[model samples]
Target: MPVEMKVLMNHIYEYQKGVRRMVLFTFNQKYEPAVVDRMRRLQLPFLLQPVGNGCLNLYFGRRECLDAVRMIVDKPLSRLTPEEDFILGAMLGYDLCAQCERYCERKCRRGHCGAAGA
Candidate 1:
Protein backbone atom coordinates (compact mmCIF):
# COMPACT_ATOMS: atom_id res chain seq x y z
CA MET A 1 0.00 0.00 0.00
CA PRO A 2 1.11 3.55 -0.70
CA VAL A 3 0.84 6.64 1.47
CA GLU A 4 -1.17 8.46 -1.19
CA MET A 5 -3.69 5.65 -1.18
CA LYS A 6 -3.93 5.78 2.60
CA VAL A 7 -4.55 9.51 2.62
CA LEU A 8 -7.11 9.18 -0.12
CA MET A 9 -9.01 6.40 1.59
CA ASN A 10 -8.93 8.20 4.92
CA HIS A 11 -10.30 11.30 3.26
CA ILE A 12 -13.19 9.28 1.96
CA TYR A 13 -14.00 7.79 5.38
CA GLU A 14 -13.40 11.05 7.25
CA TYR A 15 -17.00 12.12 6.82
CA GLN A 16 -18.49 9.15 8.66
CA LYS A 17 -19.25 9.94 12.28
CA GLY A 18 -20.12 8.25 15.59
CA VAL A 19 -18.41 5.06 14.51
CA ARG A 20 -16.03 3.60 17.05
CA ARG A 21 -12.43 3.88 15.89
CA MET A 22 -9.96 1.07 16.54
CA VAL A 23 -6.26 1.55 16.12
CA LEU A 24 -4.37 -1.58 15.13
CA PHE A 25 -0.73 -1.02 15.84
CA THR A 26 1.57 -3.45 14.04
CA PHE A 27 4.76 -3.79 16.01
CA ASN A 28 8.03 -5.63 15.74
CA GLN A 29 8.51 -8.71 17.91
CA LYS A 30 10.44 -6.48 20.28
CA TYR A 31 8.63 -3.58 21.88
CA GLU A 32 9.52 -0.15 20.62
CA PRO A 33 9.44 2.72 23.09
CA ALA A 34 8.20 5.18 20.50
CA VAL A 35 5.09 3.14 19.83
CA VAL A 36 4.24 3.24 23.52
CA ASP A 37 4.54 7.02 23.44
CA ARG A 38 2.34 7.21 20.36
CA MET A 39 -0.31 5.08 22.02
CA ARG A 40 -0.24 7.21 25.15
CA ARG A 41 -0.62 10.36 23.06
CA LEU A 42 -3.71 9.12 21.29
CA GLN A 43 -6.58 11.23 22.72
CA LEU A 44 -9.54 9.56 21.06
CA PRO A 45 -11.22 6.41 22.36
CA PHE A 46 -9.27 3.32 21.30
CA LEU A 47 -8.68 -0.37 21.76
CA LEU A 48 -5.41 -2.16 21.13
CA GLN A 49 -5.34 -4.87 18.49
CA PRO A 50 -2.00 -6.62 18.81
CA VAL A 51 -0.76 -8.94 16.10
CA GLY A 52 1.03 -12.05 17.28
CA ASN A 53 3.84 -11.66 14.76
CA GLY A 54 4.75 -8.08 15.54
CA CYS A 55 1.78 -5.92 14.59
CA LEU A 56 -1.01 -4.10 16.37
CA ASN A 57 -4.12 -2.07 15.59
CA LEU A 58 -4.98 1.03 17.64
CA TYR A 59 -8.63 1.82 17.20
CA PHE A 60 -9.65 5.41 17.93
CA GLY A 61 -12.54 7.71 16.96
CA ARG A 62 -15.21 6.95 14.42
CA ARG A 63 -13.07 8.45 11.71
CA GLU A 64 -9.94 6.75 12.96
CA CYS A 65 -10.46 3.84 10.62
CA LEU A 66 -8.21 5.80 8.35
CA ASP A 67 -5.37 5.20 10.77
CA ALA A 68 -5.49 1.53 9.86
CA VAL A 69 -4.88 2.50 6.30
CA ARG A 70 -2.16 4.85 7.40
CA MET A 71 -0.42 2.14 9.40
CA ILE A 72 -0.41 -0.33 6.54
CA VAL A 73 0.79 2.18 4.03
CA ASP A 74 3.29 3.93 6.27
CA LYS A 75 4.86 1.00 8.09
CA PRO A 76 7.82 -0.77 6.49
CA LEU A 77 7.98 -4.46 5.73
CA SER A 78 10.99 -4.95 7.99
CA ARG A 79 8.89 -4.02 10.98
CA LEU A 80 6.62 -7.06 10.79
CA THR A 81 6.63 -10.74 9.92
CA PRO A 82 5.64 -11.82 6.44
CA GLU A 83 2.28 -13.01 7.71
CA GLU A 84 1.72 -10.03 9.95
CA ASP A 85 2.81 -7.69 7.19
CA PHE A 86 0.48 -9.46 4.80
CA ILE A 87 -2.39 -9.12 7.26
CA LEU A 88 -1.71 -5.43 7.84
CA GLY A 89 -1.51 -4.86 4.12
CA ALA A 90 -4.83 -6.59 3.69
CA MET A 91 -6.38 -4.39 6.36
CA LEU A 92 -5.27 -1.31 4.45
CA GLY A 93 -7.09 -2.48 1.32
CA TYR A 94 -4.07 -4.11 -0.24
CA ASP A 95 -4.52 -7.84 -0.41
CA LEU A 96 -1.10 -9.40 -0.69
CA CYS A 97 -2.15 -12.78 0.59
CA ALA A 98 -3.49 -15.45 -1.71
CA GLN A 99 -6.60 -17.27 -0.50
CA CYS A 100 -4.46 -20.03 0.95
CA GLU A 101 -2.47 -17.57 3.01
CA ARG A 102 -5.52 -16.69 5.04
CA TYR A 103 -5.01 -19.76 7.15
CA CYS A 104 -1.72 -18.41 8.44
CA GLU A 105 -2.61 -14.75 8.43
CA ARG A 106 -3.28 -13.03 11.74
CA LYS A 107 -6.89 -12.67 12.85
CA CYS A 108 -7.14 -8.89 12.79
CA ARG A 109 -10.32 -9.15 10.75
CA ARG A 110 -12.23 -10.20 13.84
CA GLY A 111 -11.42 -6.74 15.35
CA HIS A 112 -9.92 -8.25 18.51
CA CYS A 113 -8.44 -11.44 19.88
CA GLY A 114 -9.07 -12.83 23.36
CA ALA A 115 -7.15 -16.04 22.69
CA ALA A 116 -4.66 -17.05 20.03
CA GLY A 117 -6.26 -16.35 16.64
CA ALA A 118 -9.62 -15.75 18.31
Candidate 2:
Protein backbone atom coordinates (compact mmCIF):
# COMPACT_ATOMS: atom_id res chain seq x y z
CA MET A 1 0.00 0.00 0.00
CA PRO A 2 1.08 3.58 -0.47
CA VAL A 3 2.15 5.61 2.52
CA GLU A 4 -0.40 7.53 4.55
CA MET A 5 -1.49 10.84 3.10
CA LYS A 6 -0.17 12.57 6.20
CA VAL A 7 3.31 11.26 5.53
CA LEU A 8 3.18 12.43 1.94
CA MET A 9 1.81 15.78 3.13
CA ASN A 10 4.71 16.21 5.53
CA HIS A 11 7.14 15.84 2.63
CA ILE A 12 5.09 18.26 0.59
CA TYR A 13 5.11 20.71 3.47
CA GLU A 14 8.88 20.57 3.64
CA TYR A 15 9.10 21.23 -0.08
CA GLN A 16 6.72 24.17 0.16
CA LYS A 17 8.75 25.56 3.04
CA GLY A 18 11.93 25.49 0.90
CA VAL A 19 13.50 23.08 3.37
CA ARG A 20 14.02 20.46 0.69
CA ARG A 21 14.97 20.73 -2.94
CA MET A 22 13.86 17.19 -3.70
CA VAL A 23 12.03 14.35 -2.01
CA LEU A 24 11.43 10.71 -2.87
CA PHE A 25 8.76 8.23 -1.86
CA THR A 26 8.18 4.61 -2.71
CA PHE A 27 4.63 3.59 -3.47
CA ASN A 28 2.78 0.75 -5.07
CA GLN A 29 2.36 1.12 -8.82
CA LYS A 30 -1.39 1.08 -8.33
CA TYR A 31 -1.16 4.46 -6.65
CA GLU A 32 0.59 6.17 -9.55
CA PRO A 33 -2.50 7.59 -11.18
CA ALA A 34 -3.85 9.06 -7.97
CA VAL A 35 -0.46 10.41 -6.98
CA VAL A 36 0.02 11.91 -10.42
CA ASP A 37 -3.39 13.52 -10.24
CA ARG A 38 -2.64 15.09 -6.90
CA MET A 39 0.69 16.44 -8.10
CA ARG A 40 -0.98 17.89 -11.16
CA ARG A 41 -3.64 19.56 -9.05
CA LEU A 42 -0.86 21.03 -6.94
CA GLN A 43 1.23 21.88 -10.02
CA LEU A 44 4.22 20.14 -8.52
CA PRO A 45 7.02 18.93 -10.77
CA PHE A 46 7.83 15.25 -10.43
CA LEU A 47 9.28 12.09 -11.91
CA LEU A 48 8.03 8.55 -11.48
CA GLN A 49 10.04 5.43 -12.20
CA PRO A 50 8.97 1.84 -11.95
CA VAL A 51 11.14 -0.18 -9.57
CA GLY A 52 9.91 -3.68 -10.17
CA ASN A 53 7.66 -5.78 -7.94
CA GLY A 54 4.72 -3.43 -8.40
CA CYS A 55 6.61 -0.56 -6.76
CA LEU A 56 7.49 2.89 -7.97
CA ASN A 57 9.83 5.60 -6.88
CA LEU A 58 8.21 9.02 -6.94
CA TYR A 59 10.51 12.02 -6.97
CA PHE A 60 9.15 15.51 -6.62
CA GLY A 61 10.62 18.95 -6.17
CA ARG A 62 12.15 21.78 -8.21
CA ARG A 63 11.85 21.33 -11.95
CA GLU A 64 15.51 21.89 -12.62
CA CYS A 65 16.49 19.39 -10.00
CA LEU A 66 14.14 16.85 -11.52
CA ASP A 67 15.54 17.57 -14.95
CA ALA A 68 19.07 17.14 -13.74
CA VAL A 69 18.12 13.85 -12.18
CA ARG A 70 16.57 12.68 -15.41
CA MET A 71 19.71 13.61 -17.29
CA ILE A 72 22.16 12.14 -14.82
CA VAL A 73 20.50 8.93 -13.86
CA ASP A 74 19.44 6.42 -16.47
CA LYS A 75 19.64 3.30 -14.34
CA PRO A 76 17.90 2.09 -11.23
CA LEU A 77 18.50 4.20 -8.12
CA SER A 78 20.26 1.26 -6.53
CA ARG A 79 22.69 1.21 -9.44
CA LEU A 80 23.59 4.88 -9.51
CA THR A 81 27.22 5.82 -10.09
CA PRO A 82 28.96 7.41 -7.13
CA GLU A 83 28.78 10.88 -8.62
CA GLU A 84 25.16 10.39 -9.48
CA ASP A 85 24.52 9.18 -5.95
CA PHE A 86 26.34 12.20 -4.56
CA ILE A 87 24.34 14.58 -6.69
CA LEU A 88 21.07 12.99 -5.68
CA GLY A 89 21.95 13.04 -2.01
CA ALA A 90 23.03 16.67 -2.16
CA MET A 91 19.86 17.70 -3.95
CA LEU A 92 17.77 15.82 -1.39
CA GLY A 93 19.28 17.87 1.48
CA TYR A 94 21.13 14.94 2.96
CA ASP A 95 24.05 15.80 5.25
CA LEU A 96 26.97 16.98 3.12
CA CYS A 97 29.55 15.25 5.24
CA ALA A 98 27.75 11.97 5.09
CA GLN A 99 27.26 12.23 1.36
CA CYS A 100 30.91 13.03 0.90
CA GLU A 101 31.93 10.10 3.04
CA ARG A 102 29.61 7.84 1.13
CA TYR A 103 30.94 9.06 -2.21
CA CYS A 104 34.55 8.55 -1.15
CA GLU A 105 33.77 5.10 0.12
CA ARG A 106 32.04 4.15 -3.08
CA LYS A 107 34.89 5.47 -5.20
CA CYS A 108 37.44 3.64 -3.06
CA ARG A 109 35.49 0.47 -3.33
CA ARG A 110 35.46 0.82 -7.10
CA GLY A 111 39.26 1.29 -7.06
CA HIS A 112 38.91 4.77 -8.43
CA CYS A 113 40.18 6.65 -5.42
CA GLY A 114 43.60 8.25 -5.60
CA ALA A 115 46.36 6.91 -3.41
CA ALA A 116 46.49 8.40 0.06
CA GLY A 117 49.04 11.21 0.63
CA ALA A 118 49.71 11.36 -3.09
Candidate 3:
Protein backbone atom coordinates (compact mmCIF):
# COMPACT_ATOMS: atom_id res chain seq x y z
CA MET A 1 0.00 0.00 0.00
CA PRO A 2 1.07 3.56 -0.49
CA VAL A 3 2.48 5.44 2.53
CA GLU A 4 -0.47 7.85 2.57
CA MET A 5 -2.99 4.99 2.47
CA LYS A 6 -1.14 3.19 5.28
CA VAL A 7 -1.19 6.33 7.40
CA LEU A 8 -4.91 6.79 6.81
CA MET A 9 -5.66 3.20 7.80
CA ASN A 10 -3.53 3.56 10.94
CA HIS A 11 -5.41 6.70 11.94
CA ILE A 12 -8.76 4.98 11.55
CA TYR A 13 -7.59 2.01 13.57
CA GLU A 14 -6.36 4.26 16.37
CA TYR A 15 -9.64 6.17 16.50
CA GLN A 16 -11.66 2.97 16.73
CA LYS A 17 -9.42 1.62 19.47
CA GLY A 18 -9.78 4.80 21.47
CA VAL A 19 -13.53 4.33 21.66
CA ARG A 20 -13.84 0.53 21.87
CA ARG A 21 -13.45 0.31 25.66
CA MET A 22 -15.36 3.26 27.03
CA VAL A 23 -18.80 2.41 28.44
CA LEU A 24 -20.43 5.15 30.42
CA PHE A 25 -23.83 6.21 31.77
CA THR A 26 -24.99 9.64 32.84
CA PHE A 27 -28.01 9.97 35.13
CA ASN A 28 -30.19 12.74 36.44
CA GLN A 29 -29.47 14.02 39.95
CA LYS A 30 -32.86 13.09 41.38
CA TYR A 31 -32.70 9.54 40.03
CA GLU A 32 -29.30 8.70 41.52
CA PRO A 33 -30.87 6.57 44.26
CA ALA A 34 -32.99 4.63 41.83
CA VAL A 35 -30.09 4.21 39.42
CA VAL A 36 -27.80 2.97 42.14
CA ASP A 37 -30.43 0.55 43.39
CA ARG A 38 -30.90 -0.79 39.90
CA MET A 39 -27.17 -1.28 39.42
CA ARG A 40 -26.89 -3.11 42.74
CA ARG A 41 -29.80 -5.36 41.89
CA LEU A 42 -28.11 -6.24 38.62
CA GLN A 43 -24.79 -6.84 40.36
CA LEU A 44 -22.53 -5.35 37.72
CA PRO A 45 -19.24 -3.57 38.41
CA PHE A 46 -18.81 0.15 37.88
CA LEU A 47 -16.62 3.14 38.61
CA LEU A 48 -18.75 6.02 39.82
CA GLN A 49 -17.58 9.49 38.83
CA PRO A 50 -19.58 11.86 40.95
CA VAL A 51 -20.72 15.02 39.22
CA GLY A 52 -22.08 17.94 41.18
CA ASN A 53 -25.69 18.14 42.42
CA GLY A 54 -26.02 14.41 43.09
CA CYS A 55 -25.46 13.37 39.50
CA LEU A 56 -22.97 10.73 38.42
CA ASN A 57 -21.00 9.24 35.57
CA LEU A 58 -20.93 5.48 35.88
CA TYR A 59 -18.29 3.69 33.85
CA PHE A 60 -17.88 0.00 33.23
CA GLY A 61 -16.52 -2.42 30.73
CA ARG A 62 -18.06 -2.40 27.29
CA ARG A 63 -19.47 -5.82 28.03
CA GLU A 64 -21.57 -4.31 30.80
CA CYS A 65 -23.43 -1.93 28.52
CA LEU A 66 -26.81 -3.59 28.72
CA ASP A 67 -26.79 -3.76 32.48
CA ALA A 68 -25.77 -0.12 32.72
CA VAL A 69 -28.60 0.90 30.42
CA ARG A 70 -31.08 -1.02 32.58
CA MET A 71 -29.94 0.89 35.65
CA ILE A 72 -31.37 4.17 34.42
CA VAL A 73 -34.60 3.04 32.83
CA ASP A 74 -37.94 1.86 34.20
CA LYS A 75 -37.71 -1.46 32.39
CA PRO A 76 -37.61 -5.10 33.35
CA LEU A 77 -34.07 -6.32 32.85
CA SER A 78 -34.13 -9.06 30.27
CA ARG A 79 -31.34 -11.20 28.94
CA LEU A 80 -28.95 -9.08 26.91
CA THR A 81 -26.85 -9.71 23.83
CA PRO A 82 -24.05 -7.63 22.33
CA GLU A 83 -26.12 -6.72 19.28
CA GLU A 84 -28.70 -5.19 21.64
CA ASP A 85 -26.17 -3.29 23.70
CA PHE A 86 -26.34 -0.10 25.77
CA ILE A 87 -25.70 2.35 22.94
CA LEU A 88 -29.07 1.52 21.48
CA GLY A 89 -30.79 0.42 24.68
CA ALA A 90 -30.40 3.82 26.28
CA MET A 91 -32.00 5.40 23.22
CA LEU A 92 -34.98 3.10 23.56
CA GLY A 93 -35.33 3.88 27.28
CA TYR A 94 -35.58 7.57 26.50
CA ASP A 95 -38.69 6.93 24.42
CA LEU A 96 -40.83 6.65 27.56
CA CYS A 97 -41.02 8.86 30.60
CA ALA A 98 -40.03 7.62 34.05
CA GLN A 99 -42.78 6.59 36.49
CA CYS A 100 -41.89 9.21 39.08
CA GLU A 101 -43.62 12.01 37.18
CA ARG A 102 -46.47 9.84 35.90
CA TYR A 103 -49.99 10.04 37.27
CA CYS A 104 -53.26 8.30 36.62
CA GLU A 105 -56.68 7.69 38.15
CA ARG A 106 -55.64 4.46 39.77
CA LYS A 107 -52.87 5.77 41.99
CA CYS A 108 -53.82 9.42 42.11
CA ARG A 109 -51.06 10.75 44.35
CA ARG A 110 -51.74 14.28 43.22
CA GLY A 111 -54.71 16.29 44.47
CA HIS A 112 -55.92 17.29 41.01
CA CYS A 113 -56.70 13.75 39.97
CA GLY A 114 -60.24 12.31 39.63
CA ALA A 115 -59.55 9.35 41.91
CA ALA A 116 -60.15 8.90 45.66
CA GLY A 117 -56.89 10.56 46.52
CA ALA A 118 -58.03 13.81 44.90
Which candidate leads the pack in lDDT? 2
Query: Candidate 2 residues 1-118, lDDT tens each?
Result: 3455667788989999988889988887887788899889999999998889998888999999999989977889889999999999998889999999999999999999887794
Which pairs clash in the backbone of model 2? none
TM-score of each: 0.28, 0.90, 0.31
Model 2: residues >4 Å from true position, as ranges? none
Alpha-carbon RMSD of each model: 12.0, 1.9, 17.3
Candidate 1, superposed: residue stretches over 4 Å from native: 1-25, 29-32, 63-118
For every model shown, the clashing-pair count is: 17, 0, 0
Indicate which candidate wins on TM-score: 2
lDDT of 2 at 101: 98
Tell how far residue 31 is off in model 2, in angstroms: 1.5
* Candidate 1 displacement at residue 11 in angstroms: 9.7
Report residue 110 deviation for candidate 2 (angstroms): 1.0
How does model 1 score by TM-score? 0.28
Lowest summed lDDT window (length 10), candidate 3: 74-83
lDDT of each: 0.46, 0.88, 0.45
Write the residue-wise lDDT of candidate 3 on 7-114 in tens digits. 434433443465434344555556556556655665544456565566565554444553645554333223332223333444333223332223242234324555
